[model samples]
Target: MSEIGIRTSGLSPYVALPAELESLENLGISEYQRAAKITDRMRPGIDIPILGLFGEVGSLLAALKKQTRDHPDREKYAASIKEELGDTLWYLANIASRTDQDLDVLAQRTVRSISDWDEVQPNFGTFDDIQSNIKELTQSEFEAILITLAGRVGDLVKDLGSGALTNNRDRLSGHLVDIFGNLLTAADAARISLGEAATANLLKVFSRWPLTEEYPPLIDDGMPDNEQIPRKFEILIEERKINGKIYVQQKLNGVIIGDRLTDNKREKDDFRFHDVFHMSYAVFLGWSPVLRNLLHLKRKSDPIIDENEDGARALLIEEGVSTFIFQRAIDRDFFKGQTQVDYDLLKSIRDFTRGFEVDRCALWQWEKAILEACRIFSELKRYRKGYIAADLISHTLEFRRVPEDRRED
Candidate 1:
């Protein structure tokens, strides 16, 4: 990754973790402060984490906004809130660490501000009494607590802007204590678990970017070669204008596979070639139900694995996630020159793929797949025809221009 350059905090930034991993049931503030220290060691100061707090708080409020004012997808909304609260908590802990403040004490002195805040409180108790206790709150009650959270975040922002935070060590510490308290208040309003939030956040943050890089363990180690996504493969993806409409087709070895594809919209957006994204999933994540189906690589020898992991249902989910991210990328000019996908986009993709085999893959793996695919997708768009190759063992993708003689369809 260092060769081509992997994403970092500045750019937006791997690991294989156990399925039932990351339990922080009795996680203490001090311990959490340490765990949240995944920032780039090169950039020291309270700035990055403090700015991250602002963005996370905004996302938390946006989730609440959608839940309250829009037709919320209840499950997605809930996952989003859990993730946002956890992120808010991490930045708060990160702030504490950078400022040399005590999250333990900040948590203890949390003023207990909201009326029903106790009911919505997170799992992290006072440093001496780490525990999880929560009761649901009415929409109005959640609103009140979250509104208070906004104010506290505003105070922290003021501290950051005032320059007092950088110049006065004592003042920064005070601001951190207050911010940590409101972090609990935000968790309460969301009725999220702090221990769970912190743990989940650690899973996500550590997984998405690298402090120490760890490539994912392949999912097809013992599977039959024909049933497994090939360790190395190349496919010819070519575009042609037939009947005044552009279409894309793919070929492996000497045989064609799958029907030719188009954007299938009133507008031609080059989505016809989106299968490039799937090829990417196969290479980086070691999971793509669509590719399994297309290449006849489904694990039929294990009927249950075939039925569940490589079934129609999983294929649809993968397709849906591709479309979802494609639309998001469209908005940003397809992430032109960008190295990473944003947190919310990754979060939503994570929620969408929650039950599938791909769920085992980490966020960074997903980001890598998406970014690499988009890179090739961009190249494919520019040249109109290319040979996209992959070496699955190395988990790398390459796009090579087709020879001029071969470019003619």
Candidate 2:
């Protein structure tokens, strides 16, 4: 291991190398070497770190695209992001190794730079202070905060140059801190501790499709097993009706609301309205025989050749639309009273939203902005053509499964 080649005794001086980077340096693997090992081929003078970094970034983006486009489980989606980030870190570490840099030193410099920036820009406080203040924000203020946070994430994605990855670790770290700072702030405001929120998210995941949740579980021949194959689009469509009913009922029971809104008439009315949205979505999906049995869906014995058009993603989008409408209703005092359940569910959904790359927050304003575009997209489609786009907007807004399919693995 080489010395960091920097002063370590002065006040706020550069620190030694991080343990992981030291280990990487010990392995004597350079960026070009690792690139060759992974690719088994290389172009001359190609920036391996840049290539690897962008590739990983693309992987993260693709996973997000699939999540929105295909509507897989939230935890699975989160895990995909985590996987890509880890890969990105590998490339980052390789870049450092090739350049004989120290991550600890880079990190300290980043903190110092941020501290200086904070002094200059008094409005943006320290990260911890920002988190503490998130809960104190008014609805409108929180909405603005979410928008700013989103813009920062976009900036980070765009600024990921290969040179930046190797020589500008401090700058990259600053972007990461900003992103995570906003996420943690939102999590704090949502009232659930990170641990609790994570647990809740996991519970939601395991409760849904526990068996085939991870990468659809490939078979020995690399093809999905006949029994373990993903559910058909038609089946999922029917399942949504039962699932939607179950969810609305559960939501009614779970939340502590005023007597005015809890009346049978009100509850029934709300559920019916929610059902209309689903029915409208079904209409948008071209009204096949599968969707025609909207009110009463029965089990089919036939092995239908599923189009696998990624309806789960559409289901998520529809739920976002419903949530957006419901939140607006809440603003209009539709809910006579309430407790924590409303906010908890809202935060979970917001954090779980794909393509946006954000965490839990009180305001749905961020989602509302994106949802408007989705609404426009939905309007452009002619019935059946809308299914794919709608799936990206919704999936996992409800829970539905037949008795035989509900067994634990």
Candidate 3:
């Protein structure tokens, strides 16, 4: 009923579409027109702000201003001036766009040339190595080195918010030149020697290095483990009969003790043996008969009671039945006053219960893993109590549901 492949019946020359040509025509006319329109609209709005800024600047120059000389409020005015300048530039961009001119390309050509000047001029001690070779070079040479570096730095600062150099042409040029200048100056100083060609080679080698890679090691050995390891404690809540009355007594026991080790050999040994120290306890609550038959708790039928029937009897029975069991670990040593614990662990417990009403196995697994990695034996003991409580709360809340009668009421 239908043709199923490329028809190729009306293929034509690859000329620009009529609509595109019309847009280009419109762009040319709009650029100049819009530039004037935008300027007229913005001038009145900016006049008062510009006047206020000038007044402030003049007062600062004369040292007659009440505000602190380098007060942060000056930065606000600077930001405002930049914003106004940006608004003016936006109109200029529209004008350029309408005239079929690419502003970004033009800007790059201009900036790249200026950056060339920045590379050759030198000023002293502007780069990090200036202090080491201060004696070898004259003041003029040092100043020249610094001036070159400063120009390159300015180019970098300009490139920060400029989207025109997406290909990083300006950045690469600026860096190469800056490093070359630094290398030449350093070599002349005799404090640290690196030729211009060698420095260029180094730059080329490092140019492709991923910026997101982990920072180079600051110290020779390794960073010390500063994180406080939590103690693990298994909290067991046992149902018992005392004085002919059924009651639950919650007991906290240290399952895995945590400790901090400075020795690298001991640290590795502790890390390997930490998993074997954990303890687990089953926390029991009331049994449900419906759960035995259904393999889960089922909705109970509501008994329809007459208005005259005892309301207190139903209320007492409902109140006496335990609907939920809660367990939490006392991971912090309150006696020792070590109180910091994983905030996400606590938040996950609350969020998991509130959102899905399911046992937060992911959270428990995370806590267990953390306890396993802990080095402090004492901190590990405290985490066991916390783990037990977290486990009980997560499990008991998962399948717990409200009665339909209660929902209707």
Candidate 4:
């Protein structure tokens, strides 16, 4: 590719630094581009990265709108902005990688857009060196600036498909520099660091979905068998009708565990079957206070563990999470035909579980838990009853046919 961006290499005397301080320092653009590589795509194409760029921009705007409207606490809005903008930056870097372009150099070109014909050489060498150039401003002043940047990015996306810039790498690269310049201005105004966003986005994305499919580690590792989630077990989940009202119940070896459940509403939404979600949480995340309570596995050997991790508060939190997600799932057809869960949904889950042991679980594990739970719940609803075979060790949940002899009439 043609080197159409910017540089100040020979003009600056630079001091190299140690590699171990990577996370603490401003992340380098080239480093982000490399780390932001998307190897987990369902299909390989430029369209994915480009479209992701536009989509993240939209999400950032939506987040800012919420921050502007509901007036959540500063910390909450700060986190929301960081996550949304971080995702936008990830897509930007990934697009550069896919298109054989240099994001850092594009940034450098925008580093000094005016009077560049003769007035060359800035005080900075790398993207991290120019953090001082960023001038902090209030959100009121720069929200419009970011919207403008969004429009510019949207134009670039439009061109990508319209043959105006599809085959022109240099022209597209120049447009990237223009957008980057505006992005820097907006980041400064919003008091956000692109580098910081880059780092945060990495954590969010990889946590949301795995780099590869593998069984994640569970929570209850060394507890006694009685206190621990069973490594593998099956529970018969059935919909039983009594008094012309339907209820969902679980039985293990002809022994009932938890109380029978119903939608507990004027209208039924199959939320009675939400017990499947709690079970999936136990099996996949190894963190479910409701299941612990039901199975008499409250980790009571230690008062602290019992009171905090397996207590009523934890149980309520888990139930609230399941219920909230259930409401969202109702509109989403219980996430039917979805291979991936939304980033914000997973983020909200993490936020709700903050300060809890299960919060330590990765987002991908949560995604798997939700998807698997929904899958089994849909099936159980269709068949009316089935055995939920749960394996904690391998982190698997399967809906199996009830044996003929064991089937309840």
TM-score of each: 0.80, 0.25, 0.19, 0.83
* Higher-lDDT candidate of 1 and 4: 1
1-409: candidate 3 lDDT, tens digit per residue: 1111111112110111122122212122223223223223233332232233233223322221222244446444333333322332333333334333443333233324654543432212221232244565653564465345345434544553464334555453444334334433433442332222222222211211211112111111121222111122243322234576433233335231222212134222222212222221111111122111112112122223211111343223222221110112223321133232354453343332332211212223323323322322234333321123322223221111223243210
**Local accuracy by lDDT, each model:** 0.75, 0.36, 0.28, 0.74
Tens digit of per-residue lDDT, candidate 1, span 114-226:
46324333334433253334577788888887777777777878877877666687666666656666666656556566667776676676777655446655777788878
Deviation from native of the Cα of residue 44 in model 3, angstroms: 42
Q: Global lDDT for candidate 3? A: 0.28
- What CA root-mean-square deviation does each model show from the true structure? 6.5, 20.1, 26.1, 7.8
Worst 10-residue lDDT window for candidate 4 reads: 1-10
On lDDT, the candidate that comes out on top is 1
| Each model's total of backbone clashes | 2, 17, 45, 0
Error of 3 at 35 (Å): 50
Query: Ten consecutive residues with minimal summed lDDT in candidate 3?
Result: 5-14
- Between 1 and 3, whose lDDT is larger? 1
For candidate 2, the 10 contiguous residues with the lowest summed lDDT are 212-221
